[model samples]
Target: DIDPELKQTYDVMNRLRETIKNRDWPNYNQAFHPLQGCSEEMLAALQTLAAHHDEIGNTFTHHYTNGPLEGSNNKIKVIKRTGFGYRNFFRFRLRVLFAFRVHTKRALITK
Candidate 1:
């Protein structure tokens, strides 16, 4: 059986996820309602959530996300790590461009 405190955490998180998915801003604010005599960790999480309220709401409100750019950055980091760092700036730039190039179609093999 899950602990009561952990269940509360999950329930709060699920509510937020559903709110964002549904773009229900009103309920999003409701999720941050004050709780008394809660665990220290939950209190800390509540503070963080309250701080980033606007940023989180803006995700669904604007329909803009940096997911694609973040993916590209991860790919570039992998290229650098696999090559153990490149000595030339031009070479690194070209490698990133070639990896992300959408003009050419190539089937990648997955293991």
Candidate 2:
């Protein structure tokens, strides 16, 4: 059997995940309060999450998200890494633009 403390920690984590997934902002505090003395490490993680709770909840409150912006950033990073030999800033900028243009064209054609 697993240790009692470990089981408690897992239970708390599962509840937190459920609360976030459901966007139950009203019961967020109640969901998290039980973690207060579960374990020092768990409590510390909980504290950090609580500190950024608003930013976290913003995902639920706002219909829009920065997912596309983050995907674009990842694509740019890939292009830069794969074409690491390019030394000119202008050339790099053009390459990024070209890559994006190709991507857009493919997306439009597939639609």
> What is the TM-score of each predicted model, taking all chains together?
0.64, 0.70
Please give the lDDT score for candidate 2. Answer: 0.79
lDDT digits (tens) for residues 1-111 of candidate 2: 367778788889888888888888777767787764377788888889889988878876888988999999999999989997688876777777787875564434421
Local error of candidate 1 at residue 45 (angstroms): 0.6
Q: Which stretches of candidate 1 lie over 4 Å from their true place?
A: 1-14, 87-91, 102-111
Clashing pairs in 2: none
**TM-score computed on alpha carbons, candidate 1:** 0.64
Model 1 clashing-pair count: 0
